[model samples]
Target: MYIHHSDVQVVFMFTERFIRYIQFEKRYSPHTVSAYQSDLDQFTGFLNNPQKLSPPPPPVITHPSQITHYHIRNWMVELMNQHIIARSINRKIATLRKYFKFLLQEGVIEINPASKINTPKIPKNLPVIVEDVKLTQMLDDNEVFGTDFKGLRDKLVIEMLFGTGMRLSELMGVKDSDINEYEGTIKVLGKRNKERIIPVNNELKLLIAEYQELKKKQDFFGNNSLTLIVTDKGANAYAKLIYLIVQKYLSYISTQNKRSPHVLRHTFATSLLNRGADLNAIKELLGHANLSATQIYTHNSVERLKSIYKQAHPKA
Candidate 1:
């Protein structure tokens, strides 16, 4: 229950170095770096250590080489008993696996206990989506737009989401140069910095093009100036703003389920699938790393079929 101060410092130093390795050497996005940092912080917190420190307690591990399967088993048991969801615990295990792999490469640990530990299996739940009538109502609810810069910006935000099926992060990261006029496509840098071109329908592109013209008339200037979506204050929109925008609009239109920005993405995927778009084609447009991730939209179609059967079948 005690680690040398020097050892703790080494761990901290290594983490900083590893973060840089992932960001620059590995070309990971800032979001990924932040997630890894958070996972490491949680893991370090669980280590029972006795150390003399000023205000905040520091980690102190005795016999670092002795980290064994029992420790990992005990951690899993603690997490399970606390009712932590299986998905979260699974992610925590992944974090540890990555960390230990790094430690092994550095010769800090003789063996990776995490490799021997089994991760909890999480059941997949059906994604919540807005129904057709409610979705129509929400998209048509332009009353959220009022006579002001903020209102115009908010309305454009929702319009872009429902119109384009862009991820909340993708919408926020958009820039002026990322849009195309002649081809009517958008260049989005998605997860892992993978770039994909999504075709923009004429209606949405014209709206965006017009919005750009209006923005230029204002003659705004800043370091983050090129961002397509922004606050009235002219800063880039955060993920929270996107969430709130969707939440407010969805509340006014739908009572079926909790409506978030992801629901818009789900709505987009399902709508496309129902309209007879190819599944693999939708996969590429959504910037999913794998087809399986995009395949969840099929469940929504199944639910739709169930609803149709319950309502129209004469067997009752």
Candidate 2:
């Protein structure tokens, strides 16, 4: 069954239903949810601190029903007084908005006071891209990678991220059976456990075949995990190891500071966009739930075009 982002977040929840709702149901990343949780906690503390809030010394509001739009406005003021940036304040406001929305859905509150709250404006930051030439040179450079299992795996990690544009989590989840070498396609499980097929080139299939052969030779540390990528000890691949592999190798060819797996993901989309691939096709390959998420690459593509124009055009 297809689970909504909110429902998926709900499934990932642990002990506290509230946070679990934020993470799995609300679909906010754990880091963002942590900040939101902190914001709510701070707001709760502020509510109890009668002096800090505008007086008649309002009574403590321990329930969502007790919250009013006025209290939220007062909290925003408090955040500004602390010299918080508009973006940070907006996030806090967002936390309350989500919180109130959840409460309203659960029938704990009749009105979402945060519903009417206006958020401060913030600047947009585009995704970072690794230049295709640099990646091409790096991958083509045999000296940079060893013929050994670890080295081949490292190269495969970079290749799959750039080649297929799958997220790091999806890469970690790849099993030996996920690749359809004959069709030259890879099926990856993306966010919320959604699966999508990304076409692989003949080169990538060969690389995977080689990696699998090496992987088979790897001793079984524990019941021989079927997970595609694995540690030296033969356990399944994990997030940190995959990150380190990307970072370590990318550092060899490019000096760009951000070399995480997601950067390769961004690079993949940017590369496709730059090469005139259809936006919708890119969206499907990346397994984005919406085209808006995939549209960010168009901005990167525009910037790259402008950069090329400046170098080639001779109006001097």
Candidate 3:
């Protein structure tokens, strides 16, 4: 039940180093780095809190080397009992696995304790998407947006998300120079700092030009900010602003409860898959690390086909 000050300090030091490792060396997105740091902090907090364990006193985890498979198992059990979802728990497990792996590589620990932990199976939920017709109707509705800077910006935000299927973070990272008018491609910096080019359509390109022109007229345009998206006040836009913009405009066309920037992404992928786009092509466009992440849209495409079959088949 007792721990030395040196051990605690070592733990904190190693954790900070690990955070920096992922934040900079690994080039993880800020959001992902924050989540990993929080997971590690939570695990460390649980170990330091002896009262959380059951009647039998567990060994004190004062250092990274003291952590073992059993401790990780116990932690997962505790998380399960707290009704934490499997996906979230699995993410925590991933964090621990990486952290311990880093520690092992650095010689801080002789063995990786989280190596043997088994995560619960997460239930598969198909990505939600708005119907293509609905999305088109919404985008084409003139009244939904206006000719003003905010309105044009809002319209283009939805356009960019749907047209290119970039993540919200990537959208925020966009710069005016990233757009290529002649090539009709947008260069986006995605997860792990990987750069990908998404080909946008002529319509979206025109919209972008229009939005830029309006933005140039604004007073904030004089600022040297390279960010493509900006607030009405001419400052750079944040995630919440993008989220609210997508949700508000989407509400005019669809009733799906989940309406966010990601919905537009899903719709983009699903639309592409439904229209005979190759899986590999879709994978490249979405900046997915692998084909597995892109395969989910196939399920949606199959479901769409089934619905069509049920409606058109007369032999039955």
- Candidate number achieving the greatest TM-score relative to the actual structure: 3
| lDDT tens per residue, model 2, 85-130 | 8988987887788777877887777999998888777767799777
Instruction: Please say which candidate is ahead in TM-score: 2 or 3.
Output: 3
lDDT of 1: 0.75
- lDDT head-to-head 1 vs 3, winner: 3
Structural similarity to truth (TM-score) of each candidate: 0.86, 0.72, 0.90
Q: What is the C-alpha lDDT of each candidate?
A: 0.75, 0.78, 0.87
Kindly list the per-residue Cα lDDT of model 1 for residues 54-93, writing each as its tens digit: 2223244443455566666666777788899998888878
User: For residue 197, what is the lDDT in candidate 2?
Assistant: 82
Ranking by TM-score: 3, 1, 2
Model 2 alpha-carbon drift over 4 Å, by segment: 1-15, 18-99, 220-226
